[model samples]
Target: MRWEFGSILPPEVKYNLCEPEILWFNKYSKCLANYMKSIGDNHGLNLTQDSKPPKSLYIEVRCLVDYGKFELDDGESILLKKNSQHLLPRAQCEPLIRQGILQHITQ
Candidate 1:
């Protein structure tokens, strides 16, 4: 609903929802907004915008902190040391990037 209608729901949809549902939707929207505002060194990222598959399978990233011993889905482990740069699988490194442990290096 948020993706289609943005933060505010249309009047037609809002009118149909019960009070609890409305409240829940509002709370959820607020939470999502808050999270989006917190990404990327306080610069913020709009996750909802350009919602599509990545153009590439891998992304270059820099470690923001010493996360240490990250395991891949293929059972390989790699050390994530601060100030180090790596080309990592996007799927596996997304959470780390979101948490600010890794910085995505975009061209």
Candidate 2:
């Protein structure tokens, strides 16, 4: 509900729910948010994004900003500079693309 309706429910909808239901909804929303945060780790992985499996293992991307170094799962670090292009792992760069720091180049 928090993802869809936001933290606070609309006034019209709130009037329809009883006191207990409203309270439960608030508590559930908080718990859900906390759980997501706990699992997100340093990169702040958003579970909602990229729900589908990638068709390819690699993708071409252009850095939108000077994001500095980005390390892969295998400990290989790559320098990311503004307008620099790279063919990187799809899974590893998905978050960066979502953040607008990298633009996926489709051919």
CA deviation > 4 Å runs, candidate 1: 2-50
Instruction: Find the candidate with the highest lDDT and give its number.
Output: 1
Per-residue lDDT tens digits for candidate 2, residues 1-107, read 55667678999989999999999999987887677677834545445455576789899999999999999987999999999999998878887998999999999
Local accuracy of candidate 1 as per-residue lDDT tens digits, 1-107:
88788899999999999999999998989999999999945757678865896899799999999899999877999999999999888867888988999999989
Q: TM-scores of all models? A: 0.59, 0.58
Candidate 2 lDDT (Cα, whole model)?
0.84
lDDT of each: 0.88, 0.84
Predicted structure 1: lDDT: 0.88
Q: Which residue pairs collide, candidate 2?
A: none
CA deviation > 4 Å runs, candidate 2? 2-16, 30-45
Per-residue lDDT, model 1, residue 1, is: 84
* Residues forming the 10-long window of minimal summed lDDT in candidate 1: 40-49
